[model samples]
Target: MGQVDPHRPPWVFDCKLTARTTPNPEKFDEALRQHVGRPGHWIDLEVRGDCSDAELELIRRLAQEADTRPVVVRHVAKLISAGQEEAGHDEPS
Candidate 1:
């Protein structure tokens, strides 16, 4: 883990990956209601640091199971950095 800058806010990213498989009837079904046809599992992935290509490739392979859906990427902004003024100004708009 990187050192946490007390003055700067953190960045967060959320990703969801899904895979289809034979749903466990015992796990999916309740005694009151029977789950007949649910056949997939939705996996929730959260990244606090940077997500590299290799890490993404592994997620892609796991999500590419039969009857699976594409991976969904979501950007969640926490707060703007308060101390990195010089770095922010160097970037072109």
Candidate 2:
């Protein structure tokens, strides 16, 4: 895990979502691809505290609406971690 910066704003907990709600499995897969692959299609969301009530509700709704099993959802934490790693590579020895 990377060090959490104390000075950074609380937006760090903010997550990005990828969703699909087609009526069939095949079309749902395509929707997932379109939302996950394209930029801006993913929405930025924040959990006020450690956990987010609204986010959970949205996830539940998405799961219920998904046409296929295992509704996929990705968060921004991984992205932030990757960026941190990239930046760390340039740090002074």
**lDDT string, candidate 2, 27-71, tens digits:** 434654554443543343322223355676675456435433434
Computed on alpha carbons, the lDDT of every model, listed in order, comes to 0.39, 0.44
Q: Score candidate 1 by lDDT.
A: 0.39
Pairs of residues at least 3 apart in sequence or in different chains that clash in candidate 2: none
lDDT tens digits by residue: candidate 1, 1-93: 778766543643223434333555453223112312244454333333345667766544544442244444332222233423322246658
Q: In candidate 1, residue 32 scores what lDDT?
A: 11
Off by over 4 Å in 1: 1-48, 72-93
User: Model 2: number of clashes?
Assistant: 0
Task: Evaluate candidate 1 by giving its C-alpha RMSD to the native, one decimal.
Answer: 12.9
Residue 56, candidate 1: how far off, in angstroms? 0.8
Model 1 residue 47 distance off true place after TM-score fit, in angstroms: 4.3
